[model samples]
Target: MTTVSPLVAAFRQASYPVGGHGRKNIQVLKEALHEFDDKLESDIYGTGESIEGFQAEMAAYVGKEKAVFFPSGTMAQQIALRIWCDEKGKRKVAYHPLSHLEIHEEDGLKELHQIESLLLGERDRLIRLEEILALNDEIACLLIELPQREIGGVLPPYEELEAISAHCRANGIKLHLDGARLYEVLPYYQKSAAELCALFDSVYISFYKGIGGVAGAILAGDEGFTAKSKVWKRRHGGDLISLYPYYLSASYYFKQREPKMGQYYKEAVELASLYNSCEHVATLPLVPVTNMFHVHISVPKEKLEPILVALYAETGVGLIHYLRESSEGVCSFEVSIGDAFAQIPKELLKRTFERMANMLQ
Candidate 1:
């Protein structure tokens, strides 16, 4: 563990948020809280009419016939796959090997739903059409995650995305989108969220990621699909007695942070390019398609951890801290930027990162 000196302690006090907190106008949250407080009656719940109102707005935003809110994307995604399998009378779903469903869900699809995954695509890189095309016809659904997160936020090109969409449509295979970071991809795609969402049969979006909500996710599809999912959601024990807080926070964050997405993309690209020029740093994909990218820096394992711990204590600059030990015994570190930290001066951050690299050498 790295010890924090007094100098580092002072720097920590001067650093910005490690998460999205005061990044927006205080009045926005004040009004949202006021609305939340006004609705804090007995049960603090919404009728179908009130729930439907929120659903309608979200559906229209994503160009879907209906939308349903769940406490999490995990439930929404599982429900989506279950619905797709039931409709098509198939048991297998195709997705990238590194998909959140496969890696993060603890085999819920297999254990709970008795559904199987085909697990197509490369693990370290973005999965392409040839990789997807190799799958057999037993697949009931295909899930595509825009800006694949685990692989350092890489994405398939626009034309390739279109080609895959076309293939799914012609084959009668249901397409489900894991759009947790869909908002971050729009500026580069030059398409509205609704337009991009229209390409899939079902689209799942998280309110907590780029939107900065406290917690919530919405799955949008045709009215029948979403209505069916509500039952599955209840079956899976996801129906909440009250959801007004999540709704209000989601709504507030959506309204406030959605506009800054374009600026974030610009800054991300600039930062990635800057890192690429440094001797010790190489950026994933060499450039960023969205506001999120990774800085892969080579450093010695012995020096890396202490420097990182010191940097965090000194500057609340929280970069992604993971070290992989190669056969040669070298360590690689990554820096990830989100809305909370994206506004900091990119040049200054890059300089500090380079200085850390020098210390390791």
Candidate 2:
């Protein structure tokens, strides 16, 4: 391991105390609470409060007839898949090999639902429409991530997305979107969340991604689908007696921060373009289509961690993350831009990277 630099050490110690992960909006939250307490005090935990109001708002936002909130995306998605499998009488779901379904969710699809995943798509690219069309008969539903995350937020083209969705519809295969960062992609795609979501039978969105909710996910679809999902939610142990805090946080963020997604997308492209100009920084897909991009640093293995620690310490700017090894000494990592990154001085980001690169050399 290489030694940590003093610059990196200083960066880590500087803390933006209020900001949490995923670009939180503290001001919006405060306002939401004041309103919640004033009009929603006794109805907290969804007892007498209008749960349907939130659901209806989410459904409208995503262009669906109904929406259901889950404590977590994991539960919401699993239940979505389970419902699809039951309805279609097929026990297979097709998704990218790197999708949250296969990578993040611990085989619960198999263990809990006994459904098999027909994984497609290469490690570094979008899953092709042909891939889904070929397996159209076997798959009960096709789960598509807008920008595939594991490979650094690569998105399929709109035409390709429409083609795949059409294939699924033509074959009677349900389409479910694993849109954890759906808000991030809308700005880049020049489409509204509802417009993008209209292609699928069910769409799931996270309140904590670009929208800045503390933690919660909404699964949107038709009224019938949501009604069925409630049953699945109960079966999977996701139903809560009260979801007030989650709703409070989710509604707070959704109303305040969701509109800023376009700004985040615009900033991400500029950020990626800046890094693309750097000599040592090579991007995964060459350009970011959403608010997330990964930078591959060609530095010695032993030097990587020290540089990361150093960078975090010096400028309090979180940069690229090396999740795993790449070919040669180069390590690839992601840069997920959010509200904090929005507030960060561009010169500071530039300086941090410049210093780190000099350290490596």
lDDT of each candidate versus the true structure: 0.76, 0.76
| Clash count per candidate | 0, 8
Most TM-score-accurate candidate = 2
Please report how far candidate 2 places residue 69 from its true position, in Å: 0.6
Q: How close is every model to the real structure, measured as TM-score?
A: 0.86, 0.88
Q: Model 1, 1-361: lDDT tens per residue? A: 9876543353345465333434445564566666554645432233555566777888999999989888899999999999999999999898889899999999999999999998776788787788766554578899999989877788777888777778888887889999998888999899999989878999999887777777789899998998899899888887878876676678777887878778777777876776677566677768888877766667666656666667656556645434665425455544344565665665657765676555555
Residue 8 lDDT, candidate 2, scale 0-100 = 41
Q: What's the true lDDT of residue 61 in model 1?
A: 90
Off by over 4 Å in 2: 1-11, 15-35, 38-47, 308-328
Where is model 2 poorest over a 10-residue stretch in terms of lDDT?
15-24
Instruction: Give the TM-score (vs. native) of candidate 1.
Output: 0.86
